[model samples]
Target: MPPSTISRVINATNGRDGELVTSQQCIDHIRTQRVNNIGHECISIIRHFQSMTANDKFGLPFAPFTGVNHHRQSTLLGCALLADEQEDTFVWLFKEWLKCMHGIEPDAIITDQDRAMCNAIHSVFPTTRHRYCYWHMQKHIIDHLPTLVSRYGEQFQRYWGLWCNSSSIEQCEGYWVEMKEKFDINEEGDGWLQTVYKCREHWVPCYLKDSFFAGMRSSQRSESINAFFDGYVNSQTQLHEFVTQYKKVVTHRRLSEAHEDFKSLNTKSVMLLGHPIEIQAGEMYTRNMFDVFHTEFKGFGTEFCEELRKDIVEYKVCKFTDRGKWEVVTYE
Candidate 1:
């Protein structure tokens, strides 16, 4: 998250030593400094090093992280302002964020495929699951392989979608082969496809389904949070005025969150399924999560249930296509 704000004076006092450094070791040394009053919610970041573009109006050191609250609304989870997009700078930023969070780490962190940010995440929070933004990945594919997209648009999406929607790791691997052959691309070559494919575990959905991302599998949510201040501050926003405006931004966002909480508590979503599982899920989850569960469950229809083995009496419930879904239950 790019720590953002109104005035240079505000962002200048992040911690001790002012983190002044020239060498890598010295850069690492200042990372120990405690960040000042950045504020918090839970976990997630705003504008995480996407393309590393600088600006005179916005997007400097202020790194805002967004998270989902109990009301299932996006909430701010603290932030930091950095001097640059260097790997060390990000490491220091992440370290400061960790301190701000009381040394607690998120279960999963999603961001754009910035190599520097990715490396910093691995160095600072190795145990956390880092997912690449599929939105960014798609943009990158079009940017890197314009010819492939323009020429083989439909066919490419067919294989690409299949690969992305694979139900298991083995199936994902098989689809990868088919995709490569469909395009007649070489696996050993150092092209865009080959390079991105090497890091499949990071971007692939089938590889990430087991992780509890709370339905946020991409960094797209962060994109909206990044724009949370668009109306408040613009390209010409002065450093000093930004401080006052930022307070309004925070207050407005908090008020919006409270409004969402009020609505969530007062309303009831229409029960689409009325099934016991759906009913139970509605009782347990917030409106947004229950809606997600309802949509997924609606796609689940058991075409048949057959006994796989009489000894264990394992019954497998699956759809005719199997591509839709497959569920197995064992009765002993």
Candidate 2:
């Protein structure tokens, strides 16, 4: 994996540059490099490049690359920042793979509104699709608009509800204005909402026909794949080991997807919770178990089906049944 190699390079360079190896030593170095005993999370920056086929078969307007070299004309580039202590390292590593192996420029990138990653992207691929993840936006809403989230929980939901759910400009705008007016708090709410709307318009241009750009929305798919490494690879693990484990997971996933099918022979609905249905054969969990839903499908299930259905009215799946279990599904 490019990330595995990248991490090794980083560690080797640091080791050669006389950087500390232990956490305590690093902490001491940071203290010596600063004032007071403030603390901060360690972070790493990695850069990568990718390329996409510029063929016009997909109805794309035109290819961005221009060169006589056949290979150079279809390349795209990317970069990522991994937290030293968090499983988010997979994100950076994945970006590296896109650049080094896929030969496709990452059309879009999504992450929390992290200043470090933002800076890294600016330095690496300034023109790449790098936007703040909607999940993170909702997180901001939760942290910043706690009162609204607690009061008109549904209304608060409407804000993000429009974000990920709305397909057309009118629908998105209408819901945005309604939510803003309902939850007016000094001008902070309005300002935040307006900023979100503008950012959404800039990054999620598929909603507007004039600036329609596909593949710019936040990528929860990558997030889902990376989530598995959360506790498995943390700040304490050596960078080399972390990359090795992540590559094994990535390889297995790719191999599995290669042997997948997307055809549907039939459709069936089953009765859930006293409702009517056709498919059945399983034991219900007798106890409440903490099940972490995949990142993309979080907040979507039978319990919240009604809410989810209302919000995702304009949903669409590119293809069905990509593999035995996992599938590639995208919605707007």
Candidate 3:
């Protein structure tokens, strides 16, 4: 906004007032999805504010609040134009968002490891589970541990995968020790590794696997949403231009979703497996969600489940491989 436009925000006649506005239509869309999937254990909130008004977060004004629906689609819950990215600014923004949603707090929220944002979330939403974007941390490791990444490469990545996918906290800890020993990582010199380990509960998978994140593990979905805006807005986009283009972006997403919903409802999905469960899932789930369920069902062909002798409801699910990957799930 120009000096003249910013000056008359309070008393302007031509619809210029506050920096923030939450759309009721977006809230209704999210509320409808919530009512439909009330059984889900986790409903996550994600805030993305990159490459919007300016390159840096402080200069950027747009914060797109998104949530995952039953279809695993990123639904826009609300949006805000912050004056700045200060801790106070973020706190106020989150509080306003909470009010707009009728004080219904989300089960979890995902964001990059920005100190101010983290602090703000902690202050405002104290009980909400907070998780950091692993991809952001991955880039941090690449930048900080370039020598280790370059020397080990794929071997490092394989070990990294094993460590990240640890089945239990103890297993994760054991893998961390093993990784340090195998790679000869210096205990005294690797400050970044130590720092990240202290905050492992926020980003590591095993610590968060039990919590529902709608199967989201990173802010990549936010990146995808930002990608959609590439054609409409760029660095040269002024505040007014951005506001105009944003409506188009939202409209495009709605049209795309409507198209998908139409296909999901009208077409018959061919079942790969002849299981009764597959048929039931196809009927119950959205097209994308059914596809996910079908893929997992296909994985059952590669794995074998063994029931515990003492308990009928307890079983071990595993693939008979040299890698020895397996998991246990209990039914009530």
Candidate 4:
């Protein structure tokens, strides 16, 4: 890949009519390429490659404008090369992609704490809930507050646990105050934390407990897609090669998902415990999900009915090596 050739390739791919195809265009291409051999199942698999977007060149301030399908188990949605991370650019890209998908709005979107991206999301999907990536937030803490972790490792761990597990706004506020007092993080010294606290509703789990985030609390899905591309393409990878390599990755992922679906449909998982809930779960959920449900269900035996009222029940949940906790709930 010579410099001149690379420049030409980049220009073509980022140009008005790039070599990269949209989701529908890819499906149509696959159908046309193998019209006689491909079936409806194959077409459905092709549809899973819903979106893909590339960012700007390698050394730009903002990375490429990449988006992935959060709905289809971390599948590549679409990628496009953007001039900048402006609100208008994001709005145009989002609208174009939405039109391709027949204007279906997502329930929730998780991304890094970028003001431009947040503004664009709000403008395009007014009703959709926007969440900050927990992983990114933690990384930011590590990157900026290294001394806090280095000097007070145990305290940092405890604070992080409280912050992540707080169930209510009051609890979150209380824990945050305790954490700040314990660490002596004043407004002047820890401005990042103070700034982040203002937007706690978007990032903190306490406020997002009821939102439908589909278990994605981070941009790990997009990160994973980027990792997949690393093996096939690199900084020097030409635009044409990227398009070809992307299709290959999509094909591999589709095959892997299809195999998993087949196994999930045909196989049954053994129950960890003989609880009625476990039995019901095995019948209702896929094997992978049943495993997760089984682990949570095993803790049920630790909870005992401490008190009972006419319409409310109080359960005493014992934590391993910790004090017993009581929770009051309505009983049907």
Local distance difference test, each candidate: 0.73, 0.45, 0.76, 0.70
Model 4 per-residue lDDT tens digits across residues 186-303: 7786566678778888887779987976566788877787787788877556567777987898798778667767777898878776778778888877666776677788677655
- Kindly indicate the candidate among 2 and 3 with the higher lDDT: 3
- lDDT, residue 64, candidate 1: 73
The TM-scores of all predictions, comma-separated, are 0.67, 0.36, 0.67, 0.64
Tens digits of per-residue lDDT for model 2 on 1-332?
34445456557777576553554555565667666433432221111111112211222111111111111111122223333423334445545655675655545545566555566655555555566666666666667566546765756765765654777777777766676566663444456655656667444434534531233334454444445445455434444565576566556544443332111112222223432211221122111111111222222321221122555575433333336443435455
User: Which ten residues in a row are the worst by lDDT in model 1?
Assistant: 1-10
Runs in model 3 with CA error above 4 Å?
A: 1-58, 146-162, 176-189, 234-244, 302-332
Give per-residue CA lDDT, model 3, range 1-332, as digits (tens): 44344445534544754643335444566679879887553432212333342443335666787777666777766678788888999999999989997887778889999899999999889888899997898888778655656765647667767887899999999988888888776668467777888888999888987688888878887777777678988766777777798898888877777887888999887798768988898888888898898889888767766777665577666665557755555544
* Model 4 regions lying over 4 Å from their true place: 1-73, 146-165, 174-190, 304-332
Model 1 TM-score is 0.67
CA lDDT, candidate 4, residue 273: 62
How well does candidate 3 match the true structure, expressed as C-alpha RMSD? 18.9
Q: Which candidate ranks first by lDDT, i.e. highest?
A: 3
What is the C-alpha lDDT profile of model 1 across 1-332, one tens digit per residue?
A: 22232223344665655554234444343454333323531222334323223325355655678787766667777655567788999998889888987898888999888889999999999899988888888788767665666665667876877887899999999998987777777866537777778889888888987788876777766677778778887755766777788888779879987887676677787787587887788777767777777778877644567778888677876565557655545545
Worst 10 residues of 3 by lDDT: 44-53
- Give the better candidate number (3 or 4) by lDDT: 3
